[model samples]
Target: MIIKPMIRSNMCINAHPIGCAKETENQINYVIAQKAKRGTKTLAEGGKAPRTVLVLGCSTGYGLASRITAAFEYGADTIGVSFEKQPTQVKGGTPGWYNNMAFDKAAEKAGLKTKTFNADAYSDECRAEVIKQLKDWGAKADLVIYSLASPVRTDPDTKVMYRSVIKPINQVYSGASLDMMTGKITQASTQPAEGDEIPNTVKVMGGEDWERWIKQLSEADVLADGCRTLAYSYIGPSLSHPIYRDGTIGEAKKDLEKRAHNIDAALKAKGGAAYVSVNKGLITRSSSVIPIITQYLGVLFKIMKKQGTHEGCIEQMERLFAERLYTADGKVPVDSENRIRMDDWEMDPKVQDEVNKVMPAVTEENVNELVDLDGIRHDFLIINGFDVDGVDYNKEVTDMSKIEY
Candidate 1:
């Protein structure tokens, strides 16, 4: 098999209107096909459909999945808030804005209302704008999903700069492989986490922002009664613990998990709830860049794929909505650690045991049998609609300045 070039661009950058639109259409079509395949009931009956939804960071990854869930499964009128940049036609354009446009087009076709706010969710001005828009629509959101991942955030009170980072927990001497051509992983080495990086990483990736979003929303009275909110997280196998769970990012996730309790208490007064779902590991743009984990992910994907239990962001989000979030009991289940155990299934003992046996011997020659590096990279490309079947990649994409929201 031939390896394609990997595209390394800015995260949370400008979006291409047409490409995003095509992506939105594609997701809607995929969801419709999936629903038909599963024969699940739509959320229309008994007035269970989400009437109003707010998705922060709705341009990519889990945020986009939540938006798709609202529109496709529950038939909700949605508002997506993101700091999406408008791409210049000269450079390779941004994808999120076009994705927004595409999603809007699908919503129109489905007879559901949709809007997008292209602004920083951390800014007071942007928050006010979203609140005003909600008031204008007279729609308090029944579900709010916070999925923002940024490097810097200002304290609402002190106005201090807080920069996020990813480091190991202990002194790590791990081996990692990279694809110099596409920046894709072909191999890697394993090691232990360093000590100092944990707190700093936790400070960055933890649940402070998530809690802040919920507090502001509740204060604004935009969260409807019985409202449910969720944030995405990940916990992989022991092989990845040093670089993942037991590492700096893991410490931050621990902070996030702790914040869930505070949020749950805050929302309980209003009959609302908050949850942090520890999702299965996949080749997200974010995950693919982490140390050592990339090769592990490639290997894990190969194992899970052979087992026929692999899932991407869409699959994870779809499951989170239908099975976890919108379930009949209205309670978000979690493990003893106060973390949802979504990844546990993916890293089952039997599965991990088998993968662990093969992990030590995995190299470029045997990687294909031990891991799904191709699949991982393929999903990464698909996030931007590259390698998507039936789509004309060379088509001249039109510029879309703004999405109405």
Candidate 2:
């Protein structure tokens, strides 16, 4: 079957395998070219690397970029766990599935150790599988990265499925938003969450899963001495606080941040540490669907690009590891909330002022020329293997869904 992008509601249901592979390669290349602009030479010209590293949600966005950086930057052996759909005769696999396949193939060609578990990362069985992989590889992980982002999570013990809400709290949130499906800026609003929305969102997106992973890994003795773990989170500027920072997802993020201390103490007992990194806003499948975020990002991207302060997934993760997390003295600098703030650039006063000036004035007519809609839109599509540079769209793409990784 020939694959073409079928998009709806800021999501592309279909993905091109070749384009997916190409996108994956592009991310990998960014890490490999350490001598380029903002050249990060953390690794001693690729002398030594991490013995073992595990990344949950290692398929898309920063999670996938982290995986590539771990292998390509630090030369670390990696094991990934993610829940992604396999393609069928009539459907295309989730972009992550193809990305993992491409990553594994590339790792093999480069003679790098890489393994992936295509299962629910929130399950006991998946944890067991990771522990088994660690034991089989004869190396406990020195680094563990949790980058899980799911709309729903099933409790392993109670077998209860909780879906997370992204609604604002207290009152309806109205703001300018960029419609990703079309090149238009529009007014977007989200009603305050209903009963149990906050609790449910926390239950689904909170740090329970991160704690579970750390606990299970610690119990299995898969964490090396002085091991470091980090999970991705977001705290955009005040513009998106209603639907992001102070909204349902914000409640979930608060829970996640609170758990960091617990995990840090737990890991400290084993000569290890854990943290939550509040990341910069970028166009991702998850964030694009959120209310009023794309418009914010559109304005943000334009400002940051002009200021030469823009950082994508690879750049952020690269900096996190090279400059922040694993520094010369091993001291990780964090904010007052006891979490790393990679969104520092985004939260800068100058940048926020620029965003605020143009946010309220955003309209369908001027959004294209005024903001970075083209750049933001392309990032969304390229992640799912559409609108990619140098990808042959005219050629027939064979619908070979599964690749043994």
Candidate 3:
């Protein structure tokens, strides 16, 4: 059947298999092109790069981008962990499932070693399987990228599941939310967190799972000497602080940042380090439904594109590896808080000033002129395998399980 995007409440609920495969291939191609342009080399060429890498939540968004950059750009053998449903005879699976298929197929054709597991990353069993795989290969992980984003996480110790919420703390949040499909603006409000909601959000989205993964890997001796680890975070403009940076999710991120220090110390004892990378905002599956993020991004994208400094997931990850993680002098440059700031360009004073100026004047009548409504809509659809280039959407997809990647 000819597939189209099924969008509701600014979220796309369905994905096209062929479109997903093509999009993954696009990211892989971008990384390969960058590798050649930047003159990056493998460890055999006497250049600095990770030999063995592990990526948790390695199937979608930034996680998948990180995996692609590591394997295609740096020639690292990668072990990926993500939970995604498989396609059935009647229906296609999640976008991440198709993306993983494309990635694995591309990696095999390129002769890059990879092992992808479809299991919960928040579980101890998943960690054990990764460790066992590393031991079997007689390889140790030198780079571990933690980029998992889930609304729910079950405690590995108690088996109790916790869900995360995006509510603000101590104050009500009211902002204009953009409907990417209809371009209709509506007033969206969320009450402050109450009744153990903050703690529960922390339990689901915080750093405990990240620390657990590191400790288990270190204990199993699956970590290489000078091993480096990173967890992705975001801190947008202060205009979004009330709903994002200072919200319940923000509290959870604080825990994530604080635990980075503990993990850093533990890894530092063995010539390793841990860091939290604050990444740029993009139209992701999770961010699309946020109170003000969609509207904010529409304005931000307009100014950034005009300035010629716009970046997507693939662009950000490539720059992170080429500039920040691996430098010529072996010194990783970071902010005063020891965190890599990939959002530097997005938060530039000039860019933010334009965004701040344009946002307040935006209305339904002039939204297209004031904001990148077309750009935002395209990005929203692209995340779920729609609006991608070089994909024949009119063609029938007979099999949901296969794609020519």
Compare the candidates by TM-score and give the number of the best one. Answer: 3
Clashes of each: 23, 0, 0
Which residue window of length 10 is worst by lDDT in model 3?
396-405
Instruction: Give model 3's TM-score versus the native structure.
Output: 0.99
Each model's Cα RMSD? 4.1, 2.3, 0.9
| Residue pairs with backbone overlap in model 3 | none
lDDT per residue as tens, model 3, 1-405: 788888778878899888888999999999999989999987867789999999999998899999999999999999999999899756889999989999999999898889999999999999999999999999999999999999999999999999999999999999998997888999999999999889999998889999999999999999998999999999998888998889999999999999999999999988999999999999998889888899899999988898899998999999999999988989998999999999999989988888888889989999889888899898888777899999988888888777762
Candidate 2 clashes: the total is 0
Better of 1 and 2 by lDDT: 2
Q: Mind giving the per-residue lDDT tens digits that candidate 1 earns over 1-405?
A: 111223553122233344455556666766676666655455565534467888988988778877997788777889998875565534444567667767777788889888898887777777788888888888888888888877766766677666655555555636566442244444444444344445545555788878877888788988899887888787787766776677667878888988999998998887888788888877666665665666677777777878888877777777777676666665667778666667866869888887788778766666666666677666766666565565555655443353222
Model 2 misplaced regions, further than 4 Å? 35-49, 402-405
Q: Kindly list the per-residue Cα lDDT of model 2 for residues 49-92, writing each as its tens digit.
A: 45678999999888988889888877788999899888875567
Each prediction's TM-score against the native?
0.87, 0.94, 0.99
The candidate with the higher TM-score, 2 or 3, is 3
Error of 2 at 83 (Å): 0.6
Error of 2 at 271 (Å): 2.7
